[model samples]
Target: MTNYRNETDWERADRNIGELLQELRIAIPGVQVLFAFLLAVPFQQRFAQVTDFQQSVYFATLLLAAASTMLLILPTAFHRLTFRKQQKERMLKLSNRSTIAGLLCLSLALIGATVLVTDFLYGSEATAVVGGASAMAFMVLWLVIPLRARRLG
Candidate 1:
């Protein structure tokens, strides 16, 4: 509804895809590193010393990272499948949704990782503070700010 450029729908879709892919390029590396770290965690000797709660958090965080990775990569796969099929608009819609969901998952994974580390290094008290702060920061920075800006614009 908000036209930033005087371009046709197809042109807009193409540009949106380009911008989305660029954003994904920025996000994918962090997700990969987090996922890799999660994957290698259980193999570490100290992993055996983790509390059951930590283990549960680790599993959830790993799954979140994996889901983020898949959702982030899905746009490219969708693009490939729809390539030259005159479905740019549809692709753009799916890509936009997938990217948003991917970012949400990534934020939750990062928060979980923070909580796990804080709990492991300190205790439940410190973990509670850090985890709450981390979640609030992500929510404000990633979700609230963007939505507020969008509404204002």
Candidate 2:
């Protein structure tokens, strides 16, 4: 039993950070691709023909993807800045906070993408329907399910 637990707070913190980094690795690539797509949209020929609402959605999606990219990359910066220090516990705590923030940004990015895609295809009503559904699904999977599992398990 004693062997199953961390010997020190630092070890526990390191383990926590390791778990967070693994999760972020999974999230970062998708956001990076989304951000890249958003970055390229303005240069497309059809961009100028989009409606005002769609243009707004495009800008918002770009910003959300940018924010998510930053959030997802925060752990690496945090670790680099704190290298050779004895602050693993603090770093891990900060990284955990950053991960939560990143996930929120990711959720927003997904919602924005859904809005942009649906708007491009079927207009505002379709945008609302798809975006709302995607956001709800994200909330349930990223938040509710995790909380329930943590509490029950």
Candidate 3:
């Protein structure tokens, strides 16, 4: 049932850690970009013209993006803190979970931010249509596809 090459425990742990680190390298930058954009939103002149709902959506999106950034970066800190403790396996496992959680937060943040922007440009009905579609896209791409792959494989 194993689709991967068989290896010793240490080898597997090393490989997993390496893979996690590489993945973090991809995730961290994207999360930081979202965080930076969200951080700058309030300073925009049009921000003050936002309706109450839009402001709420913006804040929610910002908070989720911030949380995602923290979660995405935690694995690096966790690895550093736990280095030389002979706990690479634990680190890998925990970081994997953290990455998943971070991704979920990121998806939500993207959905809310998209909705806020779309609503600003269009209207509430347009926001609902665009946001719903965007959320579904993320859910399918991020969650459903991965889960289905794991289940089928």
In candidate 3, the residue pairs with backbone N, CA or C atoms under 3 Å apart (3 or more residues apart, or in different chains) clash, namely none
Off by over 4 Å in 2: 1-6
lDDT of 3 by residue, 40-80 (tens): 99999999999999999999999999999888888889888
For each candidate, the alpha-carbon lDDT, in order, equals 0.95, 0.84, 0.90
Candidate 1 per-residue lDDT over residues 92-144, each given as its tens digit: 88889999999999999999999999999999999999999999999999999
Best-to-worst order by TM-score is 1, 3, 2
What root-mean-square deviation over C-alphas does model 3 reach? 2.1
Model 1 Cα RMSD, Å? 1.7
Against the true structure, what is each candidate's TM-score?
A: 0.96, 0.92, 0.94
- TM-score for candidate 3, please give it: 0.94
Which residue pairs in model 2 clash with each other?
none
Q: State which candidate has the highest lDDT.
A: 1
